[model samples]
Target chain A: MSSFAPVLHSEWLKIRSVRSQCLALAAVLVSTTAFSVLMCATLSAEDTSEAGFDPVRASFFGLNFGQIAAICFGSLAVAGEYRNGAVLVSLTAVPRRGLFYTAKLTVVGLLALAVGLLTSATCFVLGQAALGDLGVGIGEPGALRSVVGCGVYLALITLFAAGLAAVLRSAPAVMGFLIPFLLMLSFVLGDVSEGGGWVDFLPDRAGQQILLQNPDGPLNPWTGTGVLVLWVAAALWVGGRRLMRRDA
Target chain B: MTSIDVTQLTKEYGGRRAVDGLTFTVRPGKVTGFLGPNGAGKSTTMRLVLGLDRPTSGTATIGGRPYAEIDEPLRHVGALLDAQAAVGSRTGRDHLRILAATARIPARRVDDVLEQAGIASAADRRIKTYSLGMRQRLGIAAALLGDPEVVMLDEPSNGLDPEGIIWIRRHVRQLAAEGRAVLVSSHLMSETASFADHLVVLGKGRLLADTGMREFIEEWTTPRVRLRTTDDVRLSAVLAEKGFHPVADDDGRWTVEGARVEDIGPLTAEAGIPILELAGEEPSLEHAYLALTAGEAEYTAPRPTAAVQEV
Candidate 1:
């Protein structure tokens, strides 16, 4: 394979150069932070008194809205190449199909990681400030994990979208498939399964376990993250295989 | 010598084969013009050569190595597959810069190629706002940025203006002269005729003719001798007696097919018929191409006159 570092740099340049892709990354930060602070401030005292009200998880309620931007960022990173037939030019430069796809995913993953980490950390700090005395600290049980888990969740979601985009070869199509699947289908899967062990294997449900405190889910937070990573790995493997087999 | 060689290459898309068993070599130090009508597999063959499309069978290599094996492929082969193969939202300079990074080409080379392609003024402008001609130039700039040994351009002159067309013709010739292998594909016969030293004509996913430009034209077309003398009627009689079939046009110029200048010149001088102009009319590349692929073309335009002449 060609030198990985230069390809990584080139892919990074590709992501930074496009205005819409960068805008999507910015949306991930803006939407996540703004919503998290709002959710923390607006939480009713009566609602907090109810059972199973995890303040740390509730602080990240804005992630429900923020994940969309992360998905878009990932999808556009790969699908944009198919937009004006730019994939041909990209593959021509780096003819090894597997290496090119890997480089592209690495760039998207890293950018998402950076944006995800900053956004998650900011949201945690700002959301705690809004919660006043009721706010949780990094020293609190599962607080640090939830804070760090937010960034991991966002990055994994981004990689998932990137992989799906490669397979589908359309940003709109990948978004169409993922948005409903993440926003509504995960709940539907839980409701239908009645908290069955099968629901723990679903990517979003398994990943969200990391962000929850005193989770009743079968898998631990780290293991839940591992499940999401497996889904991402499977997705990327399929996408890479298709990319290598198909004509540019 | 950085030549491109393909042996029995084939690509099948479903039941249809886009490029079937194509075998040819594009040598360095000369511009080889790839000619075929639309759907004749010119683009498909190019994609196969560049390793964009996986061949169903056989191999295509550059300098005895598959394109996938080459590190920094842009440094070995510079190809302009499509002008629109770029992010329109980015400035033209950014597109070249990203590609330059891939090849580890210096940042200054981006500006140099922009100047070389005559798009220096529009380098910082977003590609979406640029014209089709400008996009083509930007693609050219990106291709030459790495200063690759082999250049493959598929229909580079399509969106170019007349001046741009001439410029590309001259540019490819210069690249070839500098000892780089240049393979250019075009449907424009006149454009290919001007700069190409060699020709590789394709028809219906198969090779039609692969030879030198002059030789291909000569082999496919009948060279005719055009004669204009003081007395056309006498000259026709004299040429008929000399075992030459000369056809007279309405303008009184007689043309003899399958004849050379040497045979006609001496006969005209011996007759002392006041030969005003006796010149050999070299067959055009267009006419020769049409003759060579007369029936092999996958799709031909409907002729208004509707007369099919046998070659």
Candidate 2:
């Protein structure tokens, strides 16, 4: 068996090379930070109660958009190889298909986690700076939980998309498959009364409960993150099977 | 030992047999040219050998071991089944770098292959910018990067210019000389005839010939004897007396088999036939190929007009 270093190195190289990945990463960083700053400016410009101007939720508001960018990047990290026919050479070199897929997921997954944590932390600090003595930061009740949850949420979204790509192997198709379910279906429908309880269990909707700014929500921050993590884990487990058994 | 042994290797998809019962052995220190027309299951066979596709019936083994069981199989068996089958957005060097990294080859070695393939200048360029010949060379470079004992390439000569063709021929011959097993596929026999020491010919999904180049040229190639004379009547009488059957083709050149040109000229002259043309058409590998796969050949080349003569 080949050492994991080179495999990881190759995977990292792939993540860094593509223009789309860079663009996606830039979108994640800039959008999250900018959105956090914008929310702070809005809060500071107007006089609002602590509940209405929760610094944690204000800073991490862009985690929603950040996750979308991360998911797109993560999905393409694996699927782009197939799109360009490099997967054949990749498989030819590694031979152990499952190991290859796992190595790729690990490197990209870790990178996503690092970026996710950094983005969330940076947004929290900057949002506090813009708070202008108005709202508390991570030191406040639920603020720390929200900040950490947002980071984990970003990483989970990326992993989930990466795993889905491993099975779909088509970036466009995976995006199409994920958009309605992750971005709209649950969140939009969950706002209504009848479907609210049921839609809250959907992956993205359940995942939002991790922010914890909504103290009266059905699930705690950890439980919401746990539900989303389970879904991501399932995607990876199934993707691993197809990666190993299916022809490259 | 045979570097590649494909025994009854069959690939079926939804009850359609893309390849069936393909059995052939590729040995070391020789170039085995795999010849087949398009859709003849050539690529499918190569994929099966690489274990990219599961065989429906039999197995494709390298040195008695399956491809999946071999760790870093590229080190033992390097393959280039498609020339432009690489990431288009990646630089040629980066492409090589990734493969080297995956196979655990040294980082510095990527430059060596770039130089070897005559693509050093283009190494930094994206594959999308490369010409067809450049991509083929890149593919060859990647195959040779492992310095493997066996190298398998499908239609490596495709889209190569004349000079590039000669370059590939020399490279394959050199690789074989270094004791590596070389398998190359092309639809044209003449393209690989001079380069391949042995051939594993395929038509449709079946093996047509598996032998050395020299033997295929000799055994199956038909030798044609041409004769001419001024005394056509006298020569005709002699031929009739000897029970020889002669039919003049378009150019009035009598194509007769089973006799040498020298023997025919003397025999016709002795019978008072004034000979104008006497030549024997030595069989080319092209002819042998035609004869071998006549039933399966999708395209039959017409005889050259010069080869047919007048009395």
Candidate 1 structure quality by residue, lDDT tens digits, A15-40 = 88999999999999999999999988
Candidate 2 global TM-score: 0.90
lDDT by candidate, in order shown: 0.90, 0.80
- By DockQ thresholds, what CAPRI class is model 2? medium
**Per-residue lDDT for B197-268 in model 1, tens only?**
999998878888899999988888998999888888778888899899999879878889989899999888
- Kindly give the stretch of ten consecutive residues in candidate 2 chain B with the minimal lDDT sum: B295-304
**What DockQ does each listed candidate score?**
0.82, 0.65
> Model 2 fnat?
0.62
Q: Give the per-residue lDDT digits (tens) of candidate 2, residues B235-301.
A: 6677667666665667766767766677677678676677788888878778888788785553535
RMSD of each: 3.4, 5.8
Model 2 segments more than 4 A misplaced:
A44-47, A50-53, A194-196, B227-253, B261-277, B296-311
Instruction: Calculate each model's fnat, 2 decimals.
Output: 0.87, 0.62
